[model samples]
Target: MKVAMWSGPRNLSTAMMYSFAQRADFAVLDEPFYGPYLRLTGLDHPMRSEVLGDRRKDAIEVEQSLMDPVPDGKPHAYHKHMCQHMIDGIPRSFMAECVNVFLIRHPARVVASFAKGYPDLTADDIGFDAQAELFDHVRSLGQTPVVIDSADIRDDPEGMLRGLCETIGLEFDPAMLSWPVGPKPYDGVWAPHWYTSLHATTGFAGPEGPLPDLNGHLAELVARTMPAYRALETKKISQSMKL
Candidate 1:
């Protein structure tokens, strides 16, 4: 199936893609937007200097490059990119045949993760406000993108996986619950944080491990995002009933 996993940074977007790609039939495409987002935002990220090192002559060139045609071959392209704001330039038609999923975390947990792991990020830099805005935008657009909680997925992979499969009109595959963990080519830019948890374990495996602790900043972010997140969650739940 053609699928696009939409998310903000630091969520388990990459790891979830890994879980899906482990199945024999799926061919995965790593974040197709990393290069584009970098070009568009022009801010320095963790590996920003290296990723953008002399690749494009200028920002304009970078934008042009992303606007170019998508390279062919992969059937199941899992885009691991940020979606803080809408790019009216890109169309729903671009993803017409694909499944779109918005991976999310409790804003508090999400903010806490960014604060601890990526101290360089500020609230705006982490895009918490913007990401929340996108949830509202999706609702306004009337699209039923599957909204998966990063915490829920980490805690109960099987249940979340089954619900996700059912929502997308796909058959459940037990294999998605667990797989041999290691590095693969399509790993995200923030693989270090993700790989540590996602590396060795297979499947959702239930919340056997300690969860990340949220701090004040995370708490603040959660307070800001909860209403919208809950609304979207309910919208998704209602849609699932029809599907």
Candidate 2:
């Protein structure tokens, strides 16, 4: 089975990737299209030159890699993807063969965390709008894509993960709750710029309290993304499980 887990920046996407990587049955792929994304958008992210030099920069080639059989004969493949990377021209049809999952975080928290590294962030940079669009697109294709909020996972890792596993037709493995401290073979080249906090941990951290206020452009970006975030929240697995 192949699982395409889509998420925006500063979410628990990497930690989730680590969780799945702990499972012996899964092979994790970290942000495979990130290099191509930077190349296409001309975004001068940290380590841009190194990322472009080391990773594949063709979207079509990357998409083909995702469609191929699991690496090293693993039974399942867990692909950690950033929604913003799906920029113009990348084909979306491969999604039909994967069990797509959306990993989301509250807009306030996302903006607050994101702005620390990317001071010039816009709503598009955070990827909430892109995520909502992909969610609707997957649904329109008759697929009930799974959505999980980062807060829910941090609050109840076992329960949320077990529920997520079941929803995606996989058995919940206790290993998904923890992983070794430090990097793995699958981390993207931009890990140093974005994964500092994650690299120091072994598992999901506790939920953060009230986020600080957003002002100026950060505030505007949050306002723009809230609608999309809220729309996707209505379909999150935690909320749906209650009904």
**Which structure among the candidates has the greatest lDDT?**
2
Candidate 2 global CA lDDT score: 0.89
**What is the total number of backbone clashes in candidate 1?**
6
Best by TM-score: 2
Backbone clash pairs for candidate 1 read: 108-218, 157-204, 177-203, 178-202, 178-203, 179-202
**Cα-based TM-score, every candidate:** 0.73, 0.96
The lDDT values for all models are 0.59, 0.89
Give residue 93's lDDT in candidate 2 (0 to 100).
76
Instruction: In angstroms, give how far residue 24 of model 2 lies from its true place.
Output: 0.5
- Evaluated at residue 21, the lDDT of candidate 2 is 94
